[model samples]
Target: MSRWSSSLWIPIVAVAILIGSILTGGRADSDPQGRPVVVYAHPPCPPDLMRYFEEAFADFRQSHPEINLQVLHITGNYEDKIKVMFAGKVAPDVIFMYPTALPAWVELGALRPLNDLLGTNVADYFAAGVRT
Candidate 1:
């Protein structure tokens, strides 16, 4: 699979965890009424995969009726757009990006460390992905 294809699960898993946390009142940063979680994904996805993403979102919505979720699919120049969003302090809660960009985002404090959010379950992620 292409790197992007493999990386797709990262956002899905993150979303699942976020929804779970919200449902159980495990995420302190989230409001009791549940805050909207904005997700940003890049293009180049196959039609079938896009369908899967939609299905996942639908399931999430059904399971967590109180949570507001928004997905933005970025087309050309995704990195630049993400940078602009960060500059405007409108970065999405979930971001799909190339691993190479992680360091810069981390340095800029645009990304949160997921160790606490993910806990030991993070070991399930690929070593390279964990590193990223």
Candidate 2:
């Protein structure tokens, strides 16, 4: 996909809960070198979990050949590190965020709503997702 279509978000974010929600703040469009880069930042995790994350992205790359997806593994003080990144105005396009931490990031204006792009109601998603 040339752009982040609503459908792609699901498979892209299936890594697990700590990789919970996606927050897009910087450099989602074409990069300075004129290439599209989408950075996915997350805290360090166990090897197997990290493997799952990679596998998902492998699928993502296959499906979206035009977008350059980069994964950033931040060690030590994940939340604080993310804050520093945001302070520098260099937040990753997709960051691993806890649902509780979401309120704070939302306040910091670090998230972009995809309800419109999704074209699906939240209720419908939870209803289906939970059963599966």
Best by lDDT: 2
Candidate 2 lDDT trough over 10 residues, lowest sum? 17-26
Question: Candidate 2: where are CA atoms >4 Å away?
Answer: 1-28, 31-35, 120-124, 127-132
Say which candidate scores most in TM-score: 2
- In candidate 2, position 11 carries an lDDT of 75
Query: Candidate 1: deviation at residue 5, Å?
Result: 50
Backbone clashes in model 2, listed as residue pairs: none
Compared with the true structure, model 2 gives a TM-score of: 0.65
Model 1: weakest 10-residue lDDT segment is 22-31
**Cα misplacement distance, residue 57 of candidate 2 (Å):** 1.0
Tell me, what's the RMSD of every candidate? 16.0, 15.8
> Any residue pairs clashing in model 1, and if so which?
none
